[model samples]
Target: MAPKVLIVLTSQATISSVDKPTGWYLPEFAHPYYKLAGKCDITIASPAGGEAPLDQGSVKMFEGDEECQKFLKEESSLWKKTEKLESFKGKASQFDAIFYVGGHGPMFDLANSAISHDIIREFYESSKVVSAVCHGPAALVNAKLSDGSYLIAGQQVTGFSNTEEDQVGMSKAMPFMLETDLKKNSGSDSLFVAAAEPWGSKVVVSGKNGKLITGQNPASAGPVGEALLQALGA
Candidate 1:
């Protein structure tokens, strides 16, 4: 059987109490979707399991892109029929890898979901590939391993940086600074591998012995997916 990948999206549609309409970044999800679609068996899931919200800013940002247009035209069941993460607990060992697609909304949901932490811990502890991009890193930063160390501890990882957050005027809007959280949560034995430039297309592949792949922003989404495929030897 082909390797199976679980793509988890945020169920919340707004950015915490900010009252701003937000959810998964379209390109962050779409770019990787197209890249991995036929290559592996993929399942899209969320905390609630249906109607994942779209961050309008991201939709507008990529509105003219061909892949985004195609994804919007169909709005397939893959996006509409996501399964609840709790349902995957029994099958966690069965998944070959997992991907967390991000947007501003994840700060409010996926990042805080106990279910999210459990799933990441499951995949990471199993040594199966674990990947995330953009704000998606929020989901993995707090995941505690069996040893109680952060999953990103000692791993080369990248996510939305402070500069990027400020550049987008979301520095204060977010409940917590993502980059700082990653480093702060980095174990005493490990720290984050910082990216040189804010918007640079960078994907940090840590865990050569363990599989943890993370990308900095939307620009890094495609590369992240490619890296996951490489990690899987696809």
Candidate 2:
């Protein structure tokens, strides 16, 4: 039987105070969704159940991406029924792994919700795959493990770097710098990594069998999925 994989997305539809549309990055979810769908049973969820919004920029950025295009054409069934994160009260053992999808929206809600932290912490402590990409790492912020330690502490991590945020000219628009927050909150065991170039692809995996995996930017989305597959023993 294929391992069950849960894909978490941000339901926050708008960028905080920016008046710009924001939600789950399309390719971040799409590429990963496609890559793992065949190898695992996938389910989608969000802070608030129902439909999760899409980032307009991601749609434009991956307009020609084959996997992304398939997602667009199959949008209705592929994405419309995300479960509410609060509803999943079972232990992390319920699934083989969990993935956090990114966008400017996650930087707003996922970063603030204690629910997100608990979910991520449960998965992390259970020795299961706990992965995030780009702004998706926002969900990992402040997530506490059972020993009263931060989840990403002393682990290698990579997310949307500060340089990329500034390059996009949304530094002031976001709640905080993703890379900076990780660096500041990460414990002695954590090593926050950054990509060499703005918008470049970078995936960092830490812990046993790559328990913790993160991707740097939109370009890292697909590769992050690939990494997850390997981590899952595909």
TM-score of each model, paired residue for residue: 0.94, 0.95
Q: Write the per-residue lDDT of candidate 2 for residues 1-234, one digit (tens) a residue.
A: 898888888888876476888888888988888789779988888988888888878889889888888888886565578898987656578888899999988898888788878888778778889999999999987787878887877778889988888988899998788888798777532477776668879999887667999999989999999999988897
State which candidate has the highest lDDT.
Answer: 2
Q: Write the per-residue lDDT of candidate 1 for residues 171-221, one digit (tens) a residue.
A: 878889998898887653235554677777888887756488889999898
Least accurate 10 contiguous residues by lDDT in model 1: 186-195
Model 1 whole-model lDDT (C-alpha atoms): 0.84
- Name the lDDT value of residue 93 in candidate 2: 84
Q: In model 2, where do residues sit more than 4 Å from their true spots? A: 188-190
Q: List the residue pairs that clash in candidate 1.
A: none
Assess candidate 2 and give its TM-score to the true structure. Answer: 0.95
Model 1, TM vs. native = 0.94
lDDT of 1 at 2: 72
The clash number for model 1 is: 0
